[model samples]
Target: MTVRTLFDRCRAFQARMPLAGFFSHSTAAVLHGLSLPKALEGDSRVHVSVVAPTRAPRGEGVVGHRVDARPSVVLVADLQVANPVAAWCQTTA
Candidate 1:
């Protein structure tokens, strides 16, 4: 999908979920400003991790992060973008 289109989709999906923060993994290398060090990037899923105490309400785009893994890091919803995985790919490549 186009970058703008995908970002819109992710933003809508994130709006529905009840999460504190969401982060990107391999797909978000560039979005997180790690474009030069892409050698460490891995995984296939557009993995978007969240830092919410309760399970985030499901919608689409993201698979939703579980609370069991994260022990800390919970910032408020002040994000500017979503579906950062795709954004990273666009930036890196």
Candidate 2:
């Protein structure tokens, strides 16, 4: 019950993976658990596709990614739902 509650109350979860930088995109994915496939793993900077107003990539305790109230998914709780693009199952897989 504790574990479930812990999980339920949680939103985004990012480990301090000892990475070089905690820039914008990576920060969002790390804290939010959203995957950044197109990004290089070691860029030490964040790069999201959306151009947000008041978006700044630097902050204290945040090595790279900076999070704010935006339309995109900003937490782990967000992953349960699918994105706008339909994810098709590949028969080949």
Candidate 3:
């Protein structure tokens, strides 16, 4: 998906989440202004992660992850996004 489309979707998804979760993986990487491989850059899904005990979000166009530990989060363009280190680690997993 185009970055603009992904960002618009991200905002909509964030508004629907009941509890706190942060954008992670490729989604967060984009929020952090990092370059991604072309394949990942083109992906349409947004990666959203919540610490365990809070059920991960489910919906179309979203990839949800339940993490055992709370990842560091930061605000990016008014959206909650995983910190750079956390986002990078999530990508590797």
Candidate 4:
């Protein structure tokens, strides 16, 4: 899918969630303008995470993570996204 379409999908997914989790992993990396491996450059899945006590989101085209600690978040393209350090660690994992 095109980048604009992917972003619209992510927005829709977040809208369905009760508490919108922050975008993480590859998704955050893209939002932050970080370089990604070629394998991940075209991935369309939205990576989202919520801190513990809040259940991880689940849906088509989404990879969800339940983190024990609250991650630092920043606004990117009007979406909540994990900070660079947290996103890097998540990508490695």
Candidate 5:
């Protein structure tokens, strides 16, 4: 999917989750202005993180994680996402 399509779809999905959702992993990396390897730039799923003790969201083109997200998630183009450090750490796991 196009970058715009991915971003738009993510934002739409985020709106439906509790308190919106925090983008994580590669998705957060992009929001934080980090460059991903060329091969991974076009991943289909939009990575998002939700609170622990909850099931990861499931659907087409979305990958979810359970984590202790910070209260200071940044907003990029109206998409809520984890901070750079948290995002980078998530990607490492």
Candidate 6:
């Protein structure tokens, strides 16, 4: 599937989620149009960062991070995605 298709799928996945969090990691990279490594290409898990007190959303295909500071974010196709810089930082750590 193409990036557009992946974004649509992410949007759909976000819609079904109850907790509020911005997409991070490879998911955010895709939203920001950043090229990803081959290993990440097959990662269907959605990466998200939630507020520290609230637990990260859990499920079969989701990777959640608990952060004390909420990172900046932007909406892509109506899905909340972490900003490129913050997402890049997240990916680095």
Among these predictions, the greatest TM-score belongs to 3
RMSD of each: 7.3, 10.9, 1.6, 1.9, 2.4, 1.9
TM-score each candidate.
0.41, 0.26, 0.87, 0.83, 0.77, 0.82
Q: Quickly count the clashes in candidate 4.
A: 0
lDDT of 2: 0.30
Candidate 3, pairs of clashing residues: 1-42
Segments in model 6 whose C-alpha atoms lie over 4 Å from true places: none
Lowest lDDT block of 10, candidate 1: 73-82
> Please, what are the lDDT tens digits per residue for candidate 1 over residues 1-93?
333444455455555545454545443443344443445343333335555566654443355554444433322243333354444543455
Candidate 3 lDDT by residue in tens digits, 1-93: 566777898898877864778898999987787777666767668999888888888888888888898777899888989999888766666
lDDT agreement of model 6 with the native: 0.78
Please provide, for model 2 over 17-37, each residue's C-alpha lDDT reduced to its tens digit, 9 standing for 90 to 100.
Answer: 222222233333343444435
The full ranking of all candidates by lDDT, starting with the best, is 3, 4, 6, 5, 1, 2
**Where is model 5 more than 4 Å wrong at Cα?**
37-39, 69-71
Report RMSD for candidate 4.
Answer: 1.9
Best candidate, lDDT: 3
TM-score of 4: 0.83
List per-prediction Cα lDDT, in the order shown: 0.44, 0.30, 0.82, 0.80, 0.74, 0.78
Query: Model 2, stretches more than 4 Å misplaced?
Result: 1-24, 46-69, 72-93
What local lDDT does model 5 show for residue 71?
A: 47
The all-Cα superposition gives candidate 3 an RMSD in Å to the true structure of: 1.6
Model 4, residue 63: C-alpha shift (Å) = 1.2
Q: Which ten residues in a row have the lowest lDDT in candidate 2?
A: 84-93
